[model samples]
Target: MLVIEHIPAAIADEILVGKERDTVVMTAEERRWGRRRLRSSAGRAVALALATGTTLAPGAIIAVEPTWYLQVEAAAEPVLAVRPRRCGWFRSGRCRARSSCASWRH
Candidate 1:
């Protein structure tokens, strides 16, 4: 599916009224953060590519089509959401970025 750049919030949720929709349950680790082509629970290789280095929260809309919406929902597994960081992490001297899950926290 064509990954959407603008979210439903950017437009409006009412646009989806009476429209077909599907939910893509993704493991926290699958997205963690950044743009990663993640596979949905339906086995469709849906791309969750985001440009702002933002992690998709559960219930967040990922993509939209002419007649449907691709949503992002967290899995039963622990949240492995990653944090956003600048490219100059090595130069800024703050390398401590939130990685995946509570177990990943340092």
Candidate 2:
């Protein structure tokens, strides 16, 4: 699964391109300074690199791919208990976005 850790850059062209599919509602972790971390409902990582300055609402698309759309879902509880263990060398093993996961292209 991918751990998206930032708001993706917005492209006007991409907005014009249009989604060939429906909007997807994915899980989002509220990150530092209002940035967002998105994960697909199926658990794949979704990348958001745009500057959305701290107010990306739930049900909003972080970014759109040709095949899939990634959105946000606010978790009422702390996100750690819900996600799988982290994928890195940290002793805490908390859920996090590794460099590999952050490398997902828009």
lDDT of 1 at 102: 26
Q: Mind giving the per-residue lDDT tens digits that candidate 2 earns over 32-70?
A: 234334445566755545455665676555556666656
Candidate 1 vs. true structure, TM-score: 0.55
lDDT of 2: 0.51
- Spell out the clash pairs found in candidate 2: 2-45, 7-48, 7-50, 8-48, 8-49, 8-50, 9-49, 9-50
Q: List residue ranges in candidate 1 displaced over 4 A.
A: 4-8, 78-106
Estimate candidate 2's RMSD in Å.
Answer: 18.4
- Model 1: weakest 10-residue lDDT segment is 97-106
Cα lDDT computed for each candidate against the true fold: 0.63, 0.51
